[model samples]
Target: MANFTLKVTRLGFSLLQSVSPRIAGKAAFRLFCMTPSSAPKGEKAKVAHAAGIAKLAGAERFTLALQGGGKAYAYRLNGGAIGRRARYLVTHGWGSSSVYMADIIETLAATGAEVIAVDFPGHGGAKGRALHMGMAVKAIAAAERRFGAFDAAIGHSFGGAALMVAAAGMLPSVPVVLPEKLVLIGSPSEMHWLFKDFGKMIGLRRAAQQALEKEVHRITGRRLEEFDASAAAGVIKRPVMIVHAEDDKEVSADHARRYAAAGESVQLHWANGFGHRRIVAAPPVLETITEFLTGDDSVREAEIVPLFDLPARRMSL
Candidate 1:
């Protein structure tokens, strides 16, 4: 009862954080960082601590060339406490770096999974490259070459779109290279929609949106018909989980609905207002993720973890 009260207090305070977007983002981030951790269940804590220590030791930052294209880059975080591992790859979205995905990586790692989280072409250490889905597909392939076949793939937003293309048979082995499951966080059903929405956020006129769409075509070679998630979703054979925030002002809940409607093996879970990026590290988000990756497919919306691990959340910094 005390623990529940503390969580509620923390969340209520979190809600009272500054209203300015920038300040609010920073405050929420700080809250996630400075918040005291609840003692993990004995086994869970051991797993997490062991994984953190080993991750510190086994961490390898490396680069690989995309077969015929340029080089791709990523970091590998191995739970040093374990020998072999079930593999998982996580991809990050625009405006955010791979640093945000570390929380999820550590949680899964503590469970004895080998984890690789990649920065997109223009994000994280992947700067100096253009943002294109094909480039992201190559990055996933390059990571596979270095890390071996993965048991799962979880991508947030734009990164999810990249993996979606890879799952749709753009990679060398197509669905074979795809892990047993694909998880998307606040992911979009259409790349064009994302571009237009982003345009509006930054004050782009309709004319500008149309012009940008032309550039998207020139760069990605994806026609308007091919822009929909349905194009690639049909080829994905593995189970998929869509995680989104119910009150997100950025990516709407409709994105999840569209994905669930079009995907062959798909699950959707809605959460509190963690928005587009914060949702990445939120506890409810991770629970849905852990459930899917571990094959506990009976994940009802209520099963989502309401509280987060503060230490893992701080690792983002």
Candidate 2:
């Protein structure tokens, strides 16, 4: 039944392309931002994981009211009133919640630094039915306002792009504090490519693509070309680590390479077989991210660990 519904929807959009490309483009934009999957199963497991991490890290969970409307769900681990080492902000990708990033949050918390993870608007417990890159940036800015400045930030997929956009000062009216270090996992380098891909998927033609881009520009006041993460990387002074799996299956590994090529400070880490979502929970990948964030040289000095040699675990994404 689900497959049938999906087919009908796809067919309808395809037909719309022939009749009105402009309308098709608008529909494509809506579909692009919509979360296709239902809420993840294993509700008890997700709760258990969150509870265990909170206990281990001495974390607190709460909600913060968004500026315009709605609310964002967030968790803070370690560093209470007394404060701690460094502070790190973490965010998840589209259609994902902060619970999926529990492993990363737990690991960061273990370092004695305050770690914050948030479910962007429309995902997790946050309010709203639709979300865009701009809103994600705004959510991050709100998190920062409540939690204070961050020494480093780690973002996965769309969340990663928001971090780059924030660092580039592209988010309107939102005050942003650029983190000293950044980690982008399986993130796209160019927003235009994403829009174009969506156009192709929905059978939209050149005119339709232009219409979609213009719609986005209406909201963001920036053209598709202006949303490039590579450009952001060039202007931002912080060191960036771009991690992508060789077989991402979603965003191409070429995006990571493009980011690495953007500047001397950008570093690329290649993982094999981790794919898109699994890369975030891979043990070695986690270790590398932790080491990079904490500035630990021991992990690298010990040996070059082969990816996928470690056991894979189920994550919330």
Candidate 3:
């Protein structure tokens, strides 16, 4: 039934494209920005459990008022160390919340760097049904204003792209201070690829595709191709660590290569076995990231570590 509904909807959109590409494009854009609702009982229980654990661990919770009349919920886990603290921020990908990044956040915090994890709009406790790259940038800006500058930031998938776009100063309206270092995992390298992929999935005509591109520019103040993470990496002169799995089925490992090719400051690490999502929680990956964020500059340029040689542990996911 769901597949049939989707097919019928696509056919209707195709027919609408024949009649008016502008209208079809507008509708397609809305659908594209719609955030998935992952509020099943098990998912809710998991989020609740994580929230409970966070509170038990003495994590500080706060909210930031967005510029566009919405709220962003964030978690601040104080570093375990007693002296000066390094500030770190973590953002999750599409359809995921800060809760999903709990492992990474906890690992960074354990390294004695104060970690802040944000739940993007329409995910976690944030309110809204629609989200886009521009909105994600604004959320990051809001977090920065609430909690000064970050020494480093780690983002996975969509969140990684948002961090690059914001740090690169691609969105003029929302200026952001680039983090001293960045860690991107399984993230898309270009925004236009997403648009083209979506177009192909929905069978959008060229006219509708063009119209959708115009709508993106009108809202984000940049063309779809302009939100390129590889280009953004060039603009950001800071160190970047890209960790990707060769077996990642969602985002190609080629995206990681593009980031490394952007500049000398970017390092690429290819982990075996772990796919798109599990890579975030893998123990070896965590160890490497912790070292990169807290270790010396020399560690930033180290070659990829062979995952099979490392001791395997059960994943939390």
TM-score for each predicted model, relative to the true structure: 0.69, 0.85, 0.89
Q: Which 10-residue span in candidate 2 carries the lowest summed lDDT?
A: 297-306
Q: Once model 2 is optimally superposed onto the true structure by TM-score, how far is the C-alpha of residue 180 displaced, in angstroms?
A: 1.1
Tell me model 2's lDDT, rounded to 2 decimals. Answer: 0.76
Clashing pairs in 1: none
For model 3, the stretches where C-alpha displacement exceeds 4 angstroms are 40-57, 79-83, 299-317
What RMSD, rounded to one decimal, does every model reach?
Answer: 12.2, 4.0, 4.0
Clashing pairs in 3: none
User: Which residue pairs collide in model 2, if any?
Assistant: none
Which portions of model 1 miss their true places by more than 4 Å? 1-58, 79-84, 170-177, 197-211, 299-305, 308-317
Native RMSD of candidate 1 (Å): 12.2
Q: Return the top candidate by TM-score.
A: 3
How well is each residue in 98-210 modelled by candidate 1, as lDDT tens digits?
A: 66567787777777787888766555566453446666777887888877888889888878877777777543432325777888887777765555444444333444445
1-317: candidate 2 lDDT, tens digit per residue? 26677678768876887899888778777876765342665876467456545553555777877667667888887757484579999988877777777788888888888899988878776777778877777788888889889899999988898899988888666676599999898888878877776666555778777878887877666777888887788789788888877677788878887897888778788776787887777788888888888775322112224454643211112
Better of 1 and 3 by TM-score: 3
Model 1 local distance difference test score: 0.63
